[model samples]
Target: MPCLARWLVLLTLLSHSAAQENVGIGLDLSVGVEGVLPSLARPANASRIFHGIVFDAGSTGTRIHVYTFIQKDPAELPLLEKETFQSVKPGLSAYADTPETAGETVRQLLRVAKKAVPHVEWERTPVVLRATAGLRLLPPKKAQALLDEVEVAFEESPFFVPDNSVHIMNGTDEGILAWVTVNFLTGQLQAKTKKTVGTLDLGGASTQITFLPKFKKTIESAPPDHIARFDLLSTTYELYTHSYLGNGIKAARLTALGALGAEGLERKVFESSCLSRKFREDWSFGGLTYKISGIPDGSTGFTECYKEMLKVVKGVIHQPPELQDSNTFYAFSYYFDIAVEAGLIDERRGGMVKVQDYSIRAKEVCNKLSMYLATKPFLCMDITYITCLLKDGFGFKDETILKLTQKVNNVETSWALGAIFDYFQNIKIH
Candidate 1:
């Protein structure tokens, strides 16, 4: 064949394969469903980049992003240009400190988004919308309210289908890690590092731990020097998952008022009541390290209170001793060895339940904690030291990860930033 003809054929084949890839649109938008933020919303300039809208609707504040991809179909030309809509409630703290206003605020923001972006396709391109993790935690009723508000804006947009075809995607730690491990081959934490075997997610409203196993990437690859290094080996997880449902501020507020009577505290006073009473009633405050009154003025005294509150929470959150005993170290280790020896890694899709390994690993972690940070092991380390280090390519201050946050509770890691970055990358293709 002629050289020109051959080159054209190869190029055509590549394009055909690329088109088959699943380049779906992703969306993330949230408004507080309860508390002071119920009426809050904000809008901002969005660009035509990816079919995504990543909203950082943390209790501290709200950020709206509506990124458009090259329209799959004609009619979305105007989105290529910048459009600015000011935030109705922009306080970063308000997203969390006062969630009651979140739903209302989000509704206000959506109105602005629709007004600023317009429903008609300016450039004649196909568009889609995606809502992510932050909004899913709302109660069914509250969630419906927020979704209803979005539906109004979605309906007005000609680009949106009556069926609300804009696919909604909320991220799970499992889904996030699946992408990370498969694509990035993120390997594993060094032995004794807190993040090995599982992930600890500490979000605005809740916290949870997810565990997986470490097997050879090739079923036959022998274990590496450190168990952490063995993460490069292919293993699976299905045993360790613990979520503190009412642990988040919103969850706390709802359950607390419901249990202790709604009048125990005013809207703003909810957190205080949690630290002193509601939290104490449920969790073991033995982990608490600071007192609110002892902190000086001008600083966020709440930060101090938050640390103590977390400690109090861990005291009471766990399985009965019987369940814990059933999940022993020897048991997990045995299962892991058998699975690897049996060449079951690929068959299971990394979803095996190494229930025993998860606990044994936890113990090994606690032992390492005593030596490295001079303290007992705590779940917070999963989010604190583990996720940040991986997301940032293992760049973080050991002082914060190992000592204050992990040991004394007077520390903060770049967890929110890490989550933001990870979430950002997943949704925005550009």
Candidate 2:
């Protein structure tokens, strides 16, 4: 073989070997990685361009965020240049029994990173995967088994794998990181007098609410765990944030239908008044298929649907008393998705919407389920859940204005970018 080809083969062999050696070794993220980051000497003439890969292992799907950054000055925070994104469906949790297949999905996504980042830069580009509510909802042993498989896939890749490259992210960190992403993208983080907007993200299995509280009383009144002191860009921010597990759109459906924790679901048919009375189907989530339907003899409308949704929302989530006083909030993910389906917001140029808009749309869709049956069977249930979640669950006023957005300045409005930024900050590259 040629010298270049032989060098490539040797690298592959070493990477595979390292992956095998690290199997089953867990890294507790609470402890800081003191000496794990690679110390590289940069040449004066070399370009300051670098890349970071973050796989957002979400409940609905697995998305890969390949971010490019340019360091204009060594003393300043690196600026995000561009981002490339792609996703695979059914999420990692769907592969609970097939952990190796979950690793295969990740490996396929790594191919996208390989194409996005230059081969010469692969060695230094750190690649990490942070599983969100999907894995968080899984049993501990099952979740760890999946993580172990993904960790091996990461180590076998050519990209730089950090000490804890694959693990389930806690709810608090998930909310705070998403807050960081939105604030950073909107330029709030760079401003001297930061008036940052709040963020509401509704995923498949969990929902998050985060904002920088202005009133001192709000901070004092909140639960101790809801407030976090996060340091980014040489500044510390005491932000109010929380991630409600099993409260996401899909998860809420199970909760409303009383199928979430019930055993022997495959043989039983869970009914919900939120759905169409004529509707019946098989819904699969987190590797289990469920038989669900609506009561044919019972009534179904927005009024009945809202009542069912409130059961999951009313006393479940803690309401931040001061959130109603906040001026602006950016709601995204499932919030944006459902709004588009209901024609409440534009798909491309996301617009500002009042909390009442969701209520109005929910009423319209729930009452007219037959019209949207072929296209969106769960439209009524989903919309109703959003309305109840915002108002009854989080205690937002109906008149409160929320900016529904999918992206800001061409980058996705998710936690992946914030995670990559946090990764670089912790490493402090020389």
Candidate 3:
């Protein structure tokens, strides 16, 4: 049999058996639903293919992920066949006042989905959009308006549009889903294993840290919302997860300038030690723009930048005791981007570096500010903040290693994949 045909047969069998076991199809927010997985039985045929479209409406950009999966057998999880990913700039938050334009962005990305999935399967492919901190930061009414606009676009698209498909995801759910994505893609969730790596996601408006707590004290000492519990593949996991708003690299930039949450942006010129002395720019975030520049007639360098970052991160972030010890963490998004720009990691393959490495690089970059200022002025601030965030904020020892990466197993590292998994298990039989 040809490769495609053989795979189809296997998938059909798996889907059939999964249906018989009452597993049902679709992703579920609640883990291990009752009667979800019973004893598997052979089906009449074994060839099934499905597709899921997930839009990550992040603070900085809106990204579309088209995922294809094939179920090989009832007893096992579906295998990912391929992924098609695309992104648009300025994020959905930028369209706060013009939600219709945000919806248009969604409409444009759906074209990619239209081309990726088979024409016959277009109507069957489920499409979902989950906005993160960007929309969450917006006024409730404005956020709802933007989501409603996106829903209208999804409804008009030639794909399966589920109810409540467009909404702002809570920070806790965001962290949990990202943890799932990293663990699942890294093969750490297979065979009921206990070993799992942690995840650190640095976005434009917020940052998330998630890991399984091994000690009871860690969970006991944590604030109520700082901890989350969920089950994946019949195993319950107690995870320490938190998303810090206004702490993302971009937001941190504002905080360092004393512009975050400040009123009357029109007359204010926020100064920071992070930028080059001569560097000045119009920075925009979360639907607001500001004039930001380095301290004029004042100091600018690693020392000054570190102090500015300290005010933004120190004592603002909860430092769990567990982080002091050695732990494996996968850092992505801005974490990966800055590392690659600093020549600390391979852009394509990624690489590992210790917490101290960021500190070292920040010093090197900040010291030679004039040389790199022409091209990447924010390099000094970004690296310095990341170093502070990992060390003083998260309480990671200087020796703690972080695997800076953009993707795992060729899949982009983000919560979107985990959201896809959740979407699949929740597919109702009706």
Question: Which segments of model 1 are wrong by more than 4 Å?
Answer: 1-50, 54-62, 67-139, 161-201, 208-212, 215-243, 249-312, 315-430
Best by TM-score: 3
lDDT of 3 by residue, 172-229 (tens): 8888889988998888876457788999999988999999887889999998889887
TM-score of each: 0.35, 0.88, 0.89
lDDT of 2 by residue, 1-430 (tens): 2222322222232233233444322222233333122122455444356678999999889999999876454334457899999999979999999999999999999999999999866776788999998888889999999999999999899988878878888888888888889988999877734699889999999999998888888889998888888665556788888899999999999999999988998689998887777889999988788999988888898999999999998778888888677568999999999999999988999999999999999999999878877789899999999999999999999999999999999999998888876665541211
Q: Write the per-residue lDDT of candidate 1 for residues 1-430, one digit (tens) a residue.
A: 3222322232222222223332221221131212111011223233223222333443223445443323222222211223232334332222333344545665556555555443433222222333333345434454454455445554454432323433333334323332232222122321222233334344434444333333333223312211121122122222233444344433333333332223323232222321222122222111111221111222222233233344435443542222222121111111222233233333223234332333334334423332322221132122222222112211222221111111001111212222322332222211
lDDT (Cα) of model 1? 0.30
lDDT for 275 (candidate 1): 28
Candidate no. 1 TM-score:
0.35
Q: What are the C-alpha RMSDs, in order, of all predicted structures?
A: 18.1, 8.2, 6.3
lDDT of 1 at 103: 50
Q: What is the lDDT of residue 23 in candidate 3?
A: 51
Relative to the unseen true structure, what is the C-alpha lDDT of residue 273 in candidate 2, on a scale of 0 to 100? 81
1 or 3: which has the higher lDDT?
3
